[model samples]
Target: MPEKKQKKRPGGMDLDQKAYQGIRQMLFFNEILPGQKIKYQDLADKIGVSITPVIHALKRLEFKNVVSHAPNRGYFVNETSLKEITEIYDTRLLLEVSLVPEIIRHLDAESMDRLGKAFDAYREAVKEENYYNRLMTDMRFHLTIASMAQCQIQLKILQELFDTLLLKYTRNLILLGIMDSSLDEHVHIVKSLTDRDMDGLRQALSTHLDHVRNHITDGFRKMFAVKPRQMVDLFSLQ
Candidate 1:
């Protein structure tokens, strides 16, 4: 006898997921902006959904530390700070470098092919001047290596960390006119991985990440110095 297929819930769960993704994108691209309080109705209206799904989405984001809720006030985008940036990159470096050996040991022809394809796509995106697409492709390249490491916990953390920092940091690097050099660093890391030289891979990865950290720190300094009022207005955004 054939097994019966269970019916899936229509609209409700799907709407919630859609709302979550919509709100997440807004947060990622600074559409909502950091430290801005988000209203449920406004989000629902923007997402073309009802308040229920929006609330559900906000709850999920809150759980992920992407958003925060208050007793009386509504949801606010999690503010990014230099201290948080430092901690995130520090943790990323520790976990990512630790995974290098495992990734190299387990890397296969198929994994190499995937990495090569992602890197090529990234290079093309960079040439096209599509910064967002280039950033995503670059992320795909690193996450592909992380996938090869087979550490689910570490992979999850890395993904979250990148999600929080990738856009802001990439934009800063692009503004600094060093995005091309960063791409070259990526090329070196890929070369090391392909050669199965763990030491080279570690050094390349460390150099790339350290550059990112320094750029982010410098960017933040310049941003705050130029727009000091923006920092003070964070809590006032509604």
Candidate 2:
């Protein structure tokens, strides 16, 4: 049977949310590449939604730095930048490392269970051989650790950072062959958590993130070297 290309909507999902997830799926599948100017009608047509919801979704994405807006230029997908992504990594390290103590302090049976399950999910997801699944499970694993800190603001910031980093650099993740080492790093993190070793936890996380950051930034250097501000349509190129 041929697989359906259309997205299935969850019950009770509003158009705005459906549009958001639809666009995100496009991004994950590489249907929407960076440096592409997103047309509201085109996005809406792809998602089977009205232009209004796509506009709202793009506005939200603009706030996350996933897209950029201009006075009359509509929205263009932001190209990857080594400098900006490196800053994101440094900022994330500062925030996540600082939250280690609180994560440890607030550790309880429920939290520990969540962390363990999240790790397990990531480990098992690797076997599924789906990039999007791996990316999402990998993200959930880290976010699970941060969620234990009980800090909503930092958690939100971290989520947005992950969103930008993972989505914008999806190409790097696919080509870097970094996921091979990620499971081992995730295991080290879980071990530190189980032992309640704050310093060790920080080390594991720092090393893991640093490795990912380095690989991605290195991979994207060539990308930025020739990156166009906006990707023009093939039809327009003529």
Candidate 3:
């Protein structure tokens, strides 16, 4: 019998994936802000794809809790409440603090060098005012430390938590002048790790997370304050 060749799949999947990533970046970079409604045609136009793929991409985002779809109102970005944000930060502190000891046990010269490089990249991003790159590199720096613990389950959970928290909040904080202090806090963390000062590392990590919680909560309160509605006369002429 002759060997049968496998049929090639249509390129629709590729387009769908591309659209998914495009919309995700839009969300991550705040091109589409939280609590804002979005139209499929608008997303299709922005992403340079047909409406079908945009719909599929949004469905995927909806599955990830990145967006919510309403029957008649279309899709809206998922909004994180102050209470939810506080709970997330609290959970993060517990997971990351527990991982610190494991990270210390697994640290080697190569790991330290990698951490240095990640830190350097983040600093460069900060200097260049590249908010998107800074956010990514900052995640990398922290994830690198988490990976040192060699616990896949813990790392995966932490990554998901970080993603959910960062999607809408961290960019606002960076814009509000929190990056400089965050970088300083990271420096203290790295120094503690380098010196194998376990107590110092715990304290530094706790302080850093506390600062993060404070900055984000404060920023949200100021940014999301309700404004008084302006009364408009229906028959007014300009």
- Least accurate stretch of 10 residues (summed lDDT) in model 2? 229-238
Expressed as tens digits, the lDDT of each residue in 63-178 for candidate 3 is 86878999988889888577777787788888888988888898899999999999999889889887767877888988888888888999999898777766666555455434
Report the Cα lDDT for residue 225, model 2.
60
lDDT of each: 0.77, 0.81, 0.78
RMSD of 2: 7.8
Clashing pairs in 3: none
Worst 10 residues of 3 by lDDT: 229-238
lDDT of 1 by residue, 27-121 (tens): 66667866778888888899888898889888987877777898788888776677877788788778889999889889999988888898999
lDDT of 2 by residue, 1-238 (tens): 9994544457868888899988887886678888898989988888889998898888888888888997788888897677887898788878888899999999999999998888888877788776656877888988999999999999999998888866677665655434478889988999999999999999998998888777777766754564355323321332
lDDT of 3 at 133: 79
Instruction: Please give me the total number of clashing residue pairs in predicted model 2.
Output: 0
Ranking, TM-score, top scorer first: 1, 2, 3
lDDT value for model 3: 0.78
- Output the lDDT of residue 238, model 1: 20
Give the higher-lDDT candidate: 1 or 3: 3
Off by over 4 Å in 3: 1-13, 129-132, 177-180, 226-238
Which candidate order results from sorting by lDDT in descending order?
Answer: 2, 3, 1
